[model samples]
Target: MKKLSIILLILGLLTGCSEKGTYIKNTTPYDEHSVENVLMSNEHVKLAKVLLYEDELLAGIRVNTFSRFKKKAIANKIQKKLEREYPDLKVTVSADSKILLETEKLINKKSEKNYRKKIDKIKSIEKEQT
Candidate 1:
């Protein structure tokens, strides 16, 4: 009886202390932009793109010619912060080929009449899924 009680106590404690959420198991990285960051950058935020795949997300932010270097640094810092905030997200880089073309296309459309409309469409889709 004493042994049984001790075993149960140990089991209960182990379960209570265990990791609580789903986490990305692999070391692989992904990249995605924080929409808030782009907004904070004011008009200097030339172009930014975010992509999600499975349990990972990726981001790429482009700056105007005069501020190219600083833009990259800021983007990198943001990426690191995001990774810390979302430890379960496999987060990483800027030039991922899978979404590179799509990102470029999105940036090009920024000046289009329907750009906001398209952004709204994307937001709607994300909203529905979440």
Candidate 2:
């Protein structure tokens, strides 16, 4: 019974430490599969919230706990890579929880009438925080 309990504890810890799946919310006509592939390629990225709006691409990522120290570097690298891939669109990638939450809200809202304005507001907030 004690050995079974120890095994169960080990399994629980392993599952808890594993990376979560990525989430991409693309309202654009572009192929979302490509973007998903790009984001999932990085092993450090655990959870991601991505929004592809008109002329802009915003992404908020949560890295593995151990990789938190270099989260900024990771975000920047991904941003640059995405920018290279889609040069016509403005790309913003952040590791902030506020940005992630806001992006998720925008995705769920499904209203494009004020998307540009909201995105700009989020960008300004990001600038202020940095």
Candidate 3:
């Protein structure tokens, strides 16, 4: 009876747990080298690809982009850069609540150089309110 109870407890613990939220992962093992970065653009249209792939992005990602660039162009540029690094991953541009919700699921990546940007929709509202 004691063994049965122990087995049931173990099974219950293992069955209910899972990792949630968005995150990037290296398909390769530790011996393989890997890098991750997040770029920024003024328009959501520019971030379509990244946002589309938000499921793979961990929080606190660092992305680079040309300052004062068009939305679509910036997205295209980022796609080009990512292609060079990860050709296997398909990237697309999509600006919508679905992608943002996925991004929100990511665990923030921490670094000395903060790449985190203020989400635009909220920023614009603040601007109007002020």
Candidate 4:
């Protein structure tokens, strides 16, 4: 009887200490779906991708410009808009083909390991370009 009571006490303690509340894994200041919507609202953008890493914001946009004069302008507009909304974050936007390609690769990565690897690669590229 004493042994059974001790076993029950241990089990009760273990169950009491176990996790019980809801844990939210996807924590970010910005809503990803909203960011995509805002980017897509611009008519020139063919593709839009956004990633938030800690306090940094990375954006990749592929645009079909009306003329050569508007190519750089479109990228600058995206940067300005994001900067206005997320002033505390380091916002970087690019229309560069390299960045767009890398974004596509990042989007396609299936597993957590591959996703982390791609994020690291994007960070390296951002460092080099900035």
TM-score of each candidate structure, all chains considered together: 0.41, 0.81, 0.31, 0.60
Q: Write the per-residue lDDT of candidate 1 for residues 3-101, one digit (tens) a residue.
A: 999999999997754422111222235433343453344454444455444455544445455765576565566667777766776554342233334
lDDT, candidate 3, 1-130, per-residue tens:
9999999999988764332222343323321122234343232222222222222222222222343335335545555665565555444332233443444443243331322243333223323532
How accurate locally, in lDDT, is each candidate? 0.49, 0.87, 0.37, 0.65
Instruction: Decide which is better by TM-score, 3 or 4.
Output: 4
- TM-score (C-alpha, index-matched) for candidate 2: 0.81
Off by over 4 Å in 4: 1-29, 65-69, 112-130
Native-vs-model 2 lDDT?
A: 0.87
TM-score top scorer: 2
Residue 11 C-alpha lDDT in model 4: 99
**lDDT winner:** 2
What does candidate 3 score on TM?
Answer: 0.31
Ranking by TM-score: 2, 4, 1, 3
